[model samples]
Target chain A: MTIAATKQFCTFFVGGHYFGVPVLDVQEAIRYQEMTSVPLSSSVVSGLINLRGQIVVAFDLRRRLELPPRSDGAKPMNVVVRHLDGVVSLLVDEIDDVVETDEVTFEPAPATLKGVAREVILGAYKLKNRLLLVLDIEKVLSIEAITSGDGDDNAS
Target chain B: MTLVGELVLARNQVLQFSATQSDPALLSATQQLNLLTSELQESVMKTRMQPIGKLWSKFPRVVRDLAGICGKRVRVQMEGEDTELDKTIIEAIGDPLTHIIRNAIDHGIEEPAIRTRRGKPEEGKLSLKAFHEGGQVNIEISDDGAGINVEKVRAKVLKQGLISPEQLTRMSERELIQLIFLPGFSTAEQVTSVSGRGVGMDVVKTNIEKIGGSLDIHSELGKGSTIKIKIPLTLAIIPALVVTSDSCRYAIPQVSLLELVRLDSEIAFKSVENIHGAPVYRLRGKLLPLVYLSSVLNTGSAQLNQDVASIDIVVLQADKLQFGLVVESIKDTAEIVVKPLGHHLKSASVFAGSTIMGDGKVALILDVVGLAEHAGLASKVEAIAASNLAGIQNDSTEGEKLLLVGVGDNSIAIHLSTVARLEEFPASAIESAGGRPVVQYRHGILPLVDLADFTGGYSAFSQNESPFQVVVCSGPHGIMGLIVDRIIDVVQENIQIQLIGERHGFIGSSIIHNKMTDLLDVHAVISSIDPSFFDEMKEALIGGVR
Candidate 1:
């Protein structure tokens, strides 16, 4: 039987940091539309948008990464991906096109990632310039983890 | 009132002035009251209860959640945004109302692209309107989306095993929606934050019902849906009637009861009959099954046979069960404040809750439908109604004997089943339909074959219980009383063959009784006499003299 090979995803940067989400999960990249707030959900779970007939929930990856909160004024773009039994569009600073890497070059995690942001990072991807943090877009945007007891404010 | 008010306000004023006028050190340490009425008013205004619409600002949220699931665009429009409710009640109605809005978006509202395809506006309109009416507030949430697919509900109900296929066939479309409230009934393949957890409608109903409220739903395919809620303005007081049954006091809501009728033993013995040991009354020509309160409570029958031997029949209408509850007497209707029953008393579903009467007596509020449900007699009521309708459909075919018998000077009517056999009495087999005086000659509607109505100029006299009347001993399901003049031979016929509409006794038989008579609509007479009397009930007109 003829074997089909999976495509290698490109590593990219936003604000001078490396990150990568699976190209397979990502449907397309688009500039932001008006996002409506989902009041009863977690802070990281931002809101939803009526995107071309499909209603997509948009989660803020910056908040999930525990970086400084974005000001309400930031005009960001969204990386739309199918997740959580439904499609979600991630509100991010930027997106990059595919760049090839050998699947054999994958590495394991060094030690404990046993903190709040551990599940967010899949095994790190090392690139020539620097390390490209492999982002587990599914885990980072999970409603359960985002709204757990460890949070400052209970989501529900 | 002024002195007490002055003391508190003045004390606060002193504290406030002392705090503002003194040195900073003393101000930090302690201060006397200095209450400007404006300051107090300012604080009150800060807490000044605004309309409950302050909470309604959350619907866009629900629309978003639902839109995410249904992949639709729903714009929520709210009116009566200034409607006010108690803070506590608002807190309770908020989550439930959100769920309703979400369901409306996810289920009622069709997909946005689908909308464009249907040649309709792409943006769906959802309105949440609340207005005060009567002593309660009515909240309505409607959506200009696809209404509930009644077919989908029917299929889902059967698929979810909520009801059998046979049941689905007979259920009205409205009944199909009711399946949504059957605890854990649902059809969604995947659970979502927006509806389909299975407890949505039931939770809404229970919460609303708890607050002395009710909900009504209206929907049509392709248009939209509306869920209207009726909730009391306040939980402080409600109209309730105090009644006694089996020596225990119950608060029956005046709203649900039809009327209270007094049945004296004198009239009771005449109208009430025992059918298969169950006492039923011929109320308005139909047999109404009598529910004695004492028996339902397992406390034995109450003594209704007092001075006048009176029994109070409290007529009730629950859903569809039109029943008469036999109680002692209705004391009075009063506005009573209800208190929740503690944990131990919660298991008693019969009592929705407990309330203190004006006389300080603790009375349990009766949940009439709950009692009928507990007894598993809800469908029995359906059987009664079906039989009544069936009675009308097969009128002349009612296969029971509307017997005509000779009284002193006239003919009287009786049920044939009550009469064993008639023989030539030689004028001595005379009996009464009761103590009524009529013609004495033995022939009656039976003698109409012999043309017997002309011998009516005879003298009349009374003969106790044994008069010349058709002996009607009240058959099990048909014909109870014997309105007889004298005994006449029994001849059976397929009752469907009604005697001609004119004054005739038996079919094709010219036997004319003293009174004008229509052929007994046998099946009707049978079922009307007692619904339990038929052999499949509909088999009534079929059972004539073979």
Candidate 2:
């Protein structure tokens, strides 16, 4: 049997940790812009940003991951990805270079992954210098679980 | 043609014209093209409009079936059916119209015997009239039945524990009649299969409001009831006022945006005051509740410079209450295409939806209704201010009666007309329900809102064993009690109300006799308890009164 060469992942930084989502899921990355905040929305929803006439819901990766806020208080980059019928912007600390690695190198999420990051992290790919936590975009952006305050029992 | 298609064509033409404006001949051609495009756009919009007769065509059959089912002699009179409206409105109005007609036949038109005894013809007259009024299609469904019995509605509401007897006493005849529209409130004693199976006027109201329309119910005892549904010509395109706050643009639908006011910093400092953390602006002669757009959305501060020369405020009217939205600045007014928010963000009530601006940036449309509710500014403060202003103008010389009530250390006087009654409820009876203190009064539930709690005053009775002195005040938010230490005497005084320090429930202070008396803002107190408390009250008032 022939083995696949490699899979590409778009990596980004959040709270000093490197996270990567499948490259196929990422549409583009743009500089952070002003966003209109939605009142009474889930805490993780950073706000709404206007992307070339398309209103995109921007989710704060740090808030979703339950990580500490950026100490420098700098506006983050927006990683636009297709989410359901529309697009959602994932706010990250910074954009890192896309890394390609063999699929076999990926491992299931470690039991040590703490807090919200553990809940959303799909798996991790070991790199030469560090570990790139693979994030499930769908799981990370599922606001229903947080808003409805329901346990992870019957999430579709 | 769809307005979206026409908009695309117009945008393209404008873009093409701007791109080649250097060519004079091309400029003239573009001008002519723009004119033709607008004219064509108007013609296309006209095609989407259909005569109201199409909507009324089925009403005859509806009325006939309704009469047969109710076993009543009825005649359907249609007028001004030629008045036209958008086809979508005509289609959406069918069900609500049927519900109203069924209501008219089953409850509006009295039985033949009762009609004859009331000295009216045995053949009841039910009129389905349509007309164009104020740029809207007004459809009136009136019937010559024994009009809605406000007393029965009051009794039903009381029995259902929707409101207190104190509230019922304060309610006007029209307001009492409107209680019929409350969900699960059917004045009909019998569970009629026809019109009153508990699935009531709320459904009809929701449907009407969903179409960007309003419902009005007017009924006179022993005469008849007229239910009017007013809908706009179209909903595809709406004029919107674009605004910026926290560096982000938002669109306020022109329908809800009443006006804009720009106040100089000096004037703003003089007029704007925070009453118990909620900002209010004194506009003209009345207090206008103000909501900071930034605070509501948890975004950056509107960053309003206190030392700046001027500040811009958008006067927004949501339902009945009018409040000022403090924004960074006001942009241009334009016709916008409203797009629904994706399913994920549907729970965000602050946004009605998103609209693309002329600059091709997505501007989240500010749902004035939602914003008002979210900011807890949905109060009857405007009405209170209006009445107070009228009193100041007309009754300055005349002594205005006031109800004196004793709170912990202070004596407060509220307008006597606004006070429903003074009652005492057992402290133990004050149960916590829906996160609010409620008491059972006269077989009805009365939400007890402690003005003293909000105003930093004291409550004398902390033990549930003691009888709680409740000063029941009636505002637009039904009836709420100002838990006081005791009820003082009713005084007729003409003392001028002097401006005191900012307080949530107190309007100001006035010297009465030897002591200083705090003048209470009755509306503010009730609204502070629950913002949405008055939203339904306004709809009910409008639906039944005018």
Candidate 3:
């Protein structure tokens, strides 16, 4: 009999889509707080928020993914994650529960998906309720698109 | 037991006990372990320390060889060689210390014959001392030879025309001595292969500052010259004050931080004034250039709202200039571990690096040097500000002498020293020559700079029957006449420059006879009329000083 390894993923909701990053890359989730806006910085850079004593750069996922911003007035959650660059906080509409899925269930991104979101997606996992799009944390935080001044967005 | 072994054991015990239910006795026992851990930490730190004598061991042989080459008889004395310093510091300071010693023997100490002729010992004494002061290690090198020749240093600087004669007249003897450290500034007449390839004290200063150290030179003619270098314990960690600007927290290294000031909204508006849109604060009777943190970071608008309740100002020293930085608030001070920024953000000039706080959030450490540059607080600007500061505090026993003149609707005071003569001319007497207004005076064609127009005032020339009164001002450039509406009077008052207005010809405003009078920058006015005026003056002044 063949067996598949079960991988855990930390998922969060942003702009009506559920996104998952490997649990190993996720640092922690904290409620969004006072963030000082850095002027003249990249547009996608929401601002810098002080998490505890450390200052973490908060990147707006909705803006990064080129999706519509949240209409609700509630403060978005911050999914603190680590990459080769340093620790960064991802701004999302809501935090979701961690899910474990078999590696066999992972599938490549569909051809219909396009733009930055599609480019950053590693693959998708078939879940009981919905499809969990796994994000390549490094590509999502690469900052090449904003810094390069292409002004290219996926949703618009 | 070894310090590390004890520390490791205590840490493991604390971790194991924390996993289970904590009793009062167990909690008290863990507190005792904390004390032991701190003691162990100090003991471990001692391992990286070594006697400074290890660094000083080679100085004697090197000094002897250098003195022989320079043809000078020198005696060396050492003290406090047992002072302890971090290993990294010892390694970094070795080369700089050697250079200073060579400079002392070659340039400072005179030859044996010259020393004997001066009625002193034939062998000049050079002393090398190291000691601990205020948590910093200080190394001093002193030579009991003919002190630095102030005249030679002055003549060299004048030949280069790097500083203006007007500036030279105001500089103190101590300030004149400091010029030797400037790059490419060698007072030596002959290029000695020993210490005079022109690359001298500037390199020494840079190397010392790189390791968080400072260098100072003190000298008295005919007595001796001393160079003191103070270095911190380590560069890996620093004590810094946390400050928030525009709601974002930043760390200012304690070394560069001078002091802090908090001003109420009402008083702040009066204390801080905007000159040509550049804010300046009057601190201790000196005009301090102010920069807003928000404005520099491109964050929220950096408007100094008149209606705000209060403001926080952090006074910081960048190089030699002291400036006040306006921030949102002042926070607690902490010992922070400095972390370098990611490569992508390395180009951000305002931040030296990022540091993780006690709570795990990252704070950007400000690069004081870069911030000063970005804000245009260059040394040249500082020199101008300093000279102007000296002019404002003209509390000489001779009294505060100023020439009062009218410009447009405002009356202004110009330093009497800046005025060469006063003249009057009718409308027909003023002639337009070379696209400038000139009037015949003494023996030459004197160019006229309109004080009103230069100070952003309305042109004073109109259909007026009254004669124009001109203040004859001479600077590094040729003499120029500043046309004014009227010549009031030359008065002496105890007034200090209370408000600094950024104008082409105006230095600041001061109260004269209970009335606010604008102070004029006569030198700047002449340059504004003819930018190359100083070039021609420089040749004449160089000849005069030589």
DockQ of all predictions against the true structure, Cα-based: 0.01, 0.15, 0.14
Model 3's DockQ? Answer: 0.14
- Best candidate, TM-score-wise? 2
CA-based DockQ, model 2: 0.15
* Chain B TM for prediction 2: 0.62
* Model 3 lDDT per residue over B1-546, tens place: 233433443354464555474687877777777677657756755877889999889988998899889998888999999999877788999899999998899889999888888988999999989888766788999999888887788888888786787877666787788888888888777888787777888899878966767788899888789998888776555678899876668998887788999999879888887655678877644567888887776666768877778988999986567888898889978665555554345445677666655444457788776687777665445454556566554443356678888777788899988899988888888876656778878866688888877667785575676788889988776788888888887777666776564666678888876677999888777767667644544554467579
- What TM-score does structure 1 among the candidates reach? 0.45
RMSD of candidates 1 onward, in order: 25.4, 19.9, 20.1
Give stretches of model 2 more than 4 Å off. Answer: A1-34, A50-53, A70-156, B1-37, B118-120, B144-192, B195-200, B219-224, B257-306, B311-317, B320-328, B348-350, B371-391, B394-546
TM of each candidate vs. truth: 0.45, 0.61, 0.50
lDDT of 3: 0.77
Preferred candidate (DockQ higher): 1 or 2: 2
lDDT of 3 by residue, A36-85 (tens): 55444566776666664445778888888888777878688899998675
Q: DockQ winner among the candidates?
A: 2
Rank ordering of all candidates by DockQ, starting from the highest: 2, 3, 1
The residue ranges of model 1 lying beyond 4 angstroms of the native Cα positions read A1-156, B1-57, B75-86, B116-122, B129-136, B154-173, B218-223, B268-290, B302-308, B317-323, B358-361, B375-377, B393-546
